[model samples]
Target: MRGFGDAAVEEVPDPVAGPGEAVVDVACVQPSVTECMLLAGEPIAMHTVLAARLAEGPVRFGGHEFAGVVRALGPGAPDGIRVGDRVTAVETAPCGRCAACRASHPHACPSPAVLGFTGPGAFAEQVLVPARTLVRVPDGVTAAQAAAIQPLAGALHGHAAAAVHPGDSVLIIGAGVMGVLHTQVARHGNAGLVMVSGRSEAKRELAGRAGADLVMDAVGDVEAAVLAATGGVGADVVFEAAGAGTFELAARCVRRGGTIVMVSVLPDHAGAPLARLRERGITVVHPRSGGGVFEHALRLVARGDVDVDCLISHRLAGVEALPEALAITRDKQRYGALGPAQVDLFDWDRAA
Candidate 1:
């Protein structure tokens, strides 16, 4: 993005791979809700860094959730990845020298290089990425599906954090992209009852299609409905994906000693029922990133276990449509979008 809330298609030199890096020809790229929020100058965690970059000049801002073919590899690139391979990458690359990495906890690394944020992203025709982050796209998974797998990986991570057990009741707030994905994941992961709450009728229906046993309007008494469904106990695990101002609802809907996974990119100091949560001994989990689940998520998509294609609502052609795609993703309800907006930059299937 050139500046906060500004994006355009402009000519720029093609990226060349540096040592330990690879250049991928982008086939499909999707704009995420988080990216749209960040671009619109939302004071999320990365706002300051983006502001600094804007002061310097126009930045190549987005396209982390993308799938493409490896075009070139530089010296010291990983051995297994080859040019022309269909691939998607984990956005976070931890510094191997950090204490977290030395302890085999790369996900906790304090210093990590984030694709599309720390460097130029895949919004253009080509993007440079660390070779180590590359994950091969399987045969059955389309470029669009691969481009959208990052969020599914995130959903998997959130589900794992909840430590769901068979026959447990699960509740998801916000039937947006993450909410539907979480619903599917929960249903497939052995949850006995899956409940979803959202403001949009269409999104609530989408959640039901994705395996939500019960769908409630967020504008209603969601807490009461959840309690009624759970036999006055409340959900065993709740995923709060509706951003700020919903933590209290999640707290109210979750059973005592249950888990609440904060899937949304919340503001620095979002209000919560802190005392209630503490008194109830609730385990609140904030899944940091979808670092290690890309391969598993891709496998699920390839095996038709997860339906990523059904969630895609808008597919615009060419990089020129990026601004429009971002707009739709930013205001999905206004645009009647069911999921993130995707832009196809190349005909990867035809080429293959």
Candidate 2:
């Protein structure tokens, strides 16, 4: 993105694999709606930082969730990573040489390289990634499935952070891709009752099909329904995946001493229900991305435990379709998109 609300495909130099890095020939990529909001320069903390950097010059923007073939290995790249191997890479990794790493606090590393946001992402035909971040695509997992795994990994992280026990009631405050993924995770973990709240009937239906025990109309009395379903005690865990204003709802719906996992990135000034949370002794958990969740997510998708196919709502062909695909991703509500807009980099011959 060149500036706020600006996105385009332009000729740029192909990236070279630096030491410890590898270049990937992207087979496919999924455009994130959250990244689209960031490209438009929303005041969200991370996006604000990115926008400041963009003020200096054009940056290769987006395509964090992608899958591809290994094109070349840089000096000292793992011998196991060979050309033509299918893989997907983690988008962000802490710089191991940072002070935080020396202190055994890698998560607090002052300088983290975030693909698509902090550096050139996979929006183009090729992208450079740290070779260490690459995970081989397991047999039977399609390129599209691999491309969509990052967020699934994120959902996994959120589920783990919630620390839900067996027979717990789970309330998800949105029925978008992340919400439904959370629903599936909860169901697989043996949650007693899994409920989803969504504004659109289509998303509600999708959530039900994705294993939600009850789909509550987000526009209606969601809290009442959730409380009623749980014998007026409320859910044991609430996942606030809907972004911004939904945090208040999650806070309100969680049982006393229950957990509310903040899954969405929010703007700096989104109001918090501190008083209510404190009074109820609700535990709020914020899980960051990383630490091998990608590997676990791939295994789940490969084993058919998490159905990524249900999340994908649209598929377009080739890099040329990138602009239109991004537009569709940005207007997800209009498109009824439960997941990111997908673009196929391969199979153009068949597409043609």
Candidate 3:
């Protein structure tokens, strides 16, 4: 497993399933936030969080979240899952026997190696995954839709954490892919009104298409817009999906006692609004997917509660193309790709 932002792609040979694991003959690869980071040589934040538990050496496994068909299964694996079945995987594979996994927090597992980031990932022709990490794609869901399920989970988690209910107004702080998806997820959760604010005009339009009730310029006074749209009470929930410098506006736009949910990974070195958030007596939830969040997110996609296929705006097919794809997605909005830049990869023959 090797290749990080702009690095050479090496054919390290194919992989095989281990005991209780499964191998999916690669049919597609889902380009995610980590894919760009890995290709750019930027460190995945999870690495530091799990550094103490790592086995050392820079891991190159990438593509933790994607969908493909099960080609083979390890002996004694969970029986319901079988060969030729289509499925998506949870974020990263953690040793399911560790204290963290036992506690239903595989995300906090001691030894965490993310796929396509620090270890063998889905970008390649085949991927080896633990049996338990798999989530089946429903009959009606296309692979492209299934491919985006993991990210939707986090967005859903944000809405769930905010307790978004019918008729309640909501505000999303950015209009990038996560921001747009959060808008749809919030609407699906029955939020009465959903508004999105971003600096990019293109993103605002994307957000509107994704079900945003109103749009505001990120460079403008978004808090005032939210208040005006709500007749002065402000929104019920504020979503900080961009992890930008201005997320603190959530404190000003959310109604007193309303919730604020951070859905993106903010650059730690950047300033955080902890003090302002506390001063406003706001409760913030930064959801980490584990336990059943991914499954819940996937089920919604499968059931058509929230449609993410529209979020895809780009597709790439090989290691060589990944660097360019990563570059474009890193500044997804700058390139005028408001939603998450979907980079779908298929074998040359199959794609034809």
Candidate 4:
């Protein structure tokens, strides 16, 4: 990104692997909703860092959610990694010397290196990543599926935080990528009833197809519908995937002492109904990252437990289509897209 909103394809020097790093030839990459928001000047979490980067001139941005073939491994790279292996990586790696890491809570590391945000990402033909972050792609999973499974991993993290029981009712707010993934995960995890609230007709249909037993219109009385569905109680767990103005709604829809997982990357100053939540004894969980569950997410995809490919509504060929892909992903409703827009850099079937 040259400026706040400018992006164009240009030749840059190919990345070289350093010690404990590996160079991956990207096969499939997708522009995340968060990345698009940042590019569009939304004051989300990474706005400050990205603004600082743009001040320096054109920045190589995006492509954390990707899959590729290992092209080269630096000295001290893990023994398991090899050239020609298909893989995807955990985007965040904790700094081992940090207090959180030293205390065995690496997921809480405050100064972790984020793949697409902290350095050069896989938006190019090749990207360099820490070898330790790489996870070998299973035999049956497609490159596209690998590239898109990061959000599913995040849904898994949120489900774990909610500690959902077999019969717990799940309510997901927003029928975007994260919301649909959370719906599928809830169904597969044995949740007795699954409900989704969405503003658009297309997304509501998508939520139903993703296994939501009930889909409610977000413009209507979603809380009343959820309450009626749960026999005047409320959903046992609510995943607040919609950004900004939906936290209070999530609180209202969840039963007392139930869980609400904030799955969206909301702005820092976004308000929450703290007093109401406290009075009801609601547990609000903010899942930091999908750090430890990449492998499990891959297994779900490989086993056909979750359908990741169906969510991909737009696919453009080659890295040159990144700008279009970004546009579609940023405004999915305008593009009628159900998931992140994927850009295929190479034919995975023919790649070495």
lDDT of every predicted structure (CA atoms): 0.91, 0.87, 0.71, 0.91
In candidate 1, which residue ranges exceed 4 Å CA deviation? none
Q: What 10-residue stretch in candidate 2 is worst by lDDT?
A: 343-352
Q: Give the TM-score of candidate 3.
A: 0.86
What is the per-residue lDDT of model 2 for residues 36-84, given as tens digits with 9 covering 90 to 100? 7787777876876787788899878888899988889989887677877
Best candidate, lDDT-wise?
A: 1
- By the lDDT metric, which is better: model 1 or model 4? 1
Candidate 2, superposed: residue stretches over 4 Å from native: 348-352
| Model 3 agreement with the true structure over 226-313: per-residue lDDT tens digits | 9899999888888887664766677788887788887766655656667766776778887766547777777777777777777777
For every candidate structure, what is the RMSD over all alpha carbons to the true structure, in angstroms?
1.2, 2.0, 3.4, 1.2
TM-score of each: 0.97, 0.96, 0.86, 0.97
Looking at model 2, the pairs that clash are: none
lDDT of 4 at 347: 74
How displaced is residue 188 in candidate 1, in Å?
0.5
